[model samples]
Target chain A: MPRPLTIEPNEKTILYTINLKTLFPVRRTLTEIFTRAPRRYVHAVDGISFMIEDGDIFGLAGESGCGKTTTGKTILRLVNPTSGVIGYRPRKQLLDAWRDMGYEPPIIDKFGSIDIAKIPGKYLKPLRREMQMIFQDPYGAFNPRYTVYQILEEPLIIHGIGETREERIDLVAKALEAVKLTPPEEFMHRHPHMLSGGQRQRVGIARALILRPRFIVADEPVSMLDVSIRAEILELMVEVKQRYNLTYLFITHDLAVSRYITNKIAIMYLGRIVEMGDTRRVLDNPLHPYTKALIEAVPDPDPKNRFRIREIPIKGEVPSAIDLPPGCRFHPRCIAFDQHPEIRKYCRTIEPPLIEVEKNHYVSCWLYGTPDEVMKLIKK
Target chain B: MSEVLMRVEGLKTYFYTARGIVKAVDNVSFTLNRGEVLGLAGESGCGKSTTAYSIIRLVPPPGRIVGGRIVFEGQDILKMSSEEYRRKIRWKKISMIFQGAMNALNPVLSIGDQMAEVFMIHKGMSKKEALEESAKLLSMVGIDPKRLRSYPHELSGGMKQRVMIAMALALNPPLVIADEPTTALDVVVQAQVMNVLKKLQKEYKVSIILITHDLSLIAEIADKVAIMYAGKIVEFGTAEHIYLNPQHPYTRGLLASIPRIRGEIKKLEWIPGIPPDLVAPPRGCRFHPRCKYKFEPCDKEEPPMVEVEPGHYVACWLYAKR
Candidate 1:
């Protein structure tokens, strides 16, 4: 009999465990090299570990400069990681190449994933077909001079998807229709400047979809758009996701948008996820103090809760990310210090590990004890 | 409702651009009462910022306030000489917290120097006195007094925004126009900065014209809201009126489109098309092409502002026919 599978059914498909660390050294002077100066890094992304099942829109939501963008870029190896593992289980065919390489990688589930970090530079090119990125700025992403057809067809040409020019044009038309820019011929001839902001973004989405990749990383795709048009793009994204069966790592600073689109969410503060779980569950019942403040700060449109002057939950401005606070990264600005004085010393000294307080929810706060201890406390 | 601090009657600001005349602020009108927070909410090119520029007489070169009666403090300030306006009215009477003003601070000058310069130039305060006043202003906006000595680069984005707020309040101009003050700041810091603005509005009794694209943010602190579309105030009403019962179709669409943090995830209703070009706007209603309720008169003739209910006005054919 086969060994009973421990992992979830969805886990057998895709899971990414990213832990990128120690980034950049702009200028290395001869004097500094001789003196052996201790290298200082931005720590753009520091030891964040989270996994989502196949077809999950895992949202990396946070404020600007919180390393959410870096996390997405690192996963695609857009920026080479100094030290980390980017584990991914591509659909079917890539497994043969893994075995052919004569590398015995550890299997997370029945469908063993290859460590993208371990994969050599040359081998990584093939994986580009498996993953793609939808950039934020539609205006800057495309060649202003290139027609919509040419822009979409370039990816197909580079990836060598079609045999002839006619086949590529047909493929481009199909891609345009998928994004709802109907009568593809009408849009095909127009340059990037001719399209509206919303339409331009739709073209951007079409370019990403033209590749037909399994995983996509959308970085604030709607932030630059007008309020009236964001919904249209979001709807297109959802429609395409269903049609293509694509999993997305949606990155944004807007939590409301995350709640609207993503199924799962991880709220990053500075360079770490303070809280993460099911989007609705985590947003409704946020566990971390930082998460609580983020929820409170979201500008709600309704007038029922008017005139509260929503208090600034966190104490002061965010501390410099270079030399972060010693213990818990959030302790300095954390309102929990006033609410729970008992954990102040612990919060000051030790960095707490992510503990599963609920079935699916995980939080890294000292206020919550171990699983057994928390269960006993709940029972009482 | 207390006292009419400023009345902008039939304000017509037009830009003589090479690409045809751009009606940036075409026949707009609104009033800002004493200590009132009026939110000028609109999408891009809807002319909220241009209206603000017109108020301060800082309408950029190509654009000029063609025809308007700005009755501020019982005086039609448009009739005042440019020299008189600069000496008494502009900056001294009504200041402005410009768009992206957070990064607009002088990089070389200390926060104190920039802030003290406002006092020294406007209020004729000595350097020693101005520096002392600058410290007090900084603290008022919730920045530490010690940061006054630091340059712009030393301060965080939030702190820089607070410094701008402090400098705006330095001359104690009764009216201040903040154009997208918290546009770039994060939510947590935005809330903090909003708290500072709210405190100033309440305790200090300063009248603020909060201009932003965000309706929810406007709903937070605005006493009244003026929704603009294609350089016209499509809807004008109290914050409650606009939020609870929006009159214009554009207002309703805008409200419905924004995803709520605390509510049912209803299907967002997009306005369907981009805003009309200011150069050559649509024939009658600028929003008619995108409007779901575009009827006979909407495409033919422009509709005048009709008082829908007490203190609520809407410029739409649906209301006009009634």
Candidate 2:
């Protein structure tokens, strides 16, 4: 029998990496500094937060440029945060020591969550293995000049996974099997050029899994794959998750993919998580206007259900992250606003906080009431 | 029945790659009625685009059309001389809005100049007259004619798409082949672009072959749909018929895999395995490996496409008795 799954508490989250209010701004530094006062930065990723369970699939979903990818990279210390807490519960206790030795992280957090402006860069490397990322474009991610074997081996040699050549080769084979790239010998000697798109993606997954990392940040890994092959890839991910007992921060624009794989889903807007909750709850009955719009936008394959249509409140382009309006970021395109006028005054003036609406469902929209009000409702 | 504006029978487009002849479009056959939208949907390298290219005879080498007939407006396009094909059919009789065709626009030229070039080439219109007509086409696709002065890069992805539509309609062709017209745009923009296509279809009465990887988009706009896999149409039916009751295993797998906006379901079912390599495609049924109901006959001989209901065609072993 399979072991029962249980979510570990945040207290036990030793490597708890918190990205509090990470903001990244587009730097027009060269043009602005010379002529006039520096321009205000684009608030790409406004303040966003979520706890990463040790072995859970933490889904980050939103439209393109909603700061999901930025949040993933910042956790790995790839991009510097603007101003917020990125507290990590590291397995290795040397992070603080490295920091004290003056290994500060980066700055001008336009879209970054924290004030990386305050941190330096030296302490980000050793912790990279704890947090790895799989990018969206399979063709673009794999090194073309190198063969498939070389691409898989490059990471192992860099991370010092194995000493001898045979041990490294064995690790590659295991990784291939995990991704169902069967009979590793068939794939070992070939270049990425010989493989199909699905195979290349499997090779990518194999490469990421070869490191035996605990947490992986996958950004739209299967979005480019064919529908016929998507299941194969997704099934491989599910199988690997169980086999390795790993934690994942799955990032994607497609909510359907998240629905199929993730336990919990977080919906983001221009730069903030508008709604997040249990996958079934969020996908089945979305709370925020933006979430509703996104859900409604996805076309159902069942043609008979075409008559039953959900209303999309927001339409048109996502507003520029820079020079954002001082209110609820979605007010401009919100359809629910017309029915609920009370949402206007404060919703446009004050930024809504992510408050728990139900036991597990968390919403940032003001309509569900403030944290205190929600708590009162819960108590009542 | 509707008069067939474009009919392609047994179309075969092959690419002579180093490894082998990739049978990109093999024995493909379909008909597009005047003032109708026929969606050609499948995954990447499914030959949806190759079918479109073959219809227009833009088959780029090392790709060549070895056989089949393409009849546009009851005229055998295959028999037309290269010059005749160019002069009469290329843009005037039938037009195309290719995937990422937004990039097809010249960066150096204004939207006005680009649209005008289509008119100048096809109609042999003078430069002055072509510019005037370009503005009308732009307005038809919901873009402001004044913005025609803007460069391709200046316009948003959606606007550039609208410009492509405008260019495709410049000569008022009876047929327009739109391959993945709005794949790159956001959902909102995708909706708007699709709306524009529907609106233009109504206005101009031009038949459209809307080819895309998205089945849902096909559901929303396409009146009829052809589900292609490994260069052949496994199933062809009305959008309502195909989406509601997919007879083919491949079609069912596609519908099951997509995540729906409404309803609470346990989990989205994913189709296992990949499409067989076209260079050496599976012997009997291409989808036999992934099909849940595969029998011995499915492994040995290809199932012929049979009509299960009015206008609904499915090629599968389960439906072989039909």
Q: What TM-score is obtained by chain A of candidate 1? A: 0.89
Given candidate 2, what's the lDDT at residue B157? 88
Candidate of highest lDDT: 1
* Candidate 1 structure quality by residue, lDDT tens digits, A24-96: 5546578878999776567678777788677889999998888899988888888777786677887665555
lDDT by residue (tens digit), candidate 2, A1-380: 11111222355342333334566556777768789866677676677766666667878998777888887777676777776666544443344544666654442223222232244565455555656788888899987888777888998888677899999888888888888888988898888887888899999888888877767889898888877677678878888888987788899888877887888888988878888778888888888888887877776665543233334467556778887867888887777766789667867787776666666677777777743464455455
Off by over 4 Å in 2: A1-9, A12-31, A92-120, A304-311, A337-343, A370-380, B123-136, B266-271, B289-292
Error at B56, model 1, angstroms: 1.0
Relative to the true structure, candidate 1 reaches a TM of: 0.94
Candidate 2: interface RMSD equals: 2.8
lDDT of 1 by residue, B228-300 (tens): 9999999999998999999899999999999988878888888887888889899988889999999889987
**Residue B228 local lDDT, model 2:** 95
Model 2 chain A weakest 10-residue run by lDDT: A1-10
Native contact recovery (fnat) for each candidate is: 0.68, 0.44
Interface RMSD of each: 1.3, 2.8
Q: How close is every model to the real structure, measured as TM-score?
A: 0.94, 0.88
Interface RMSD of 1: 1.3
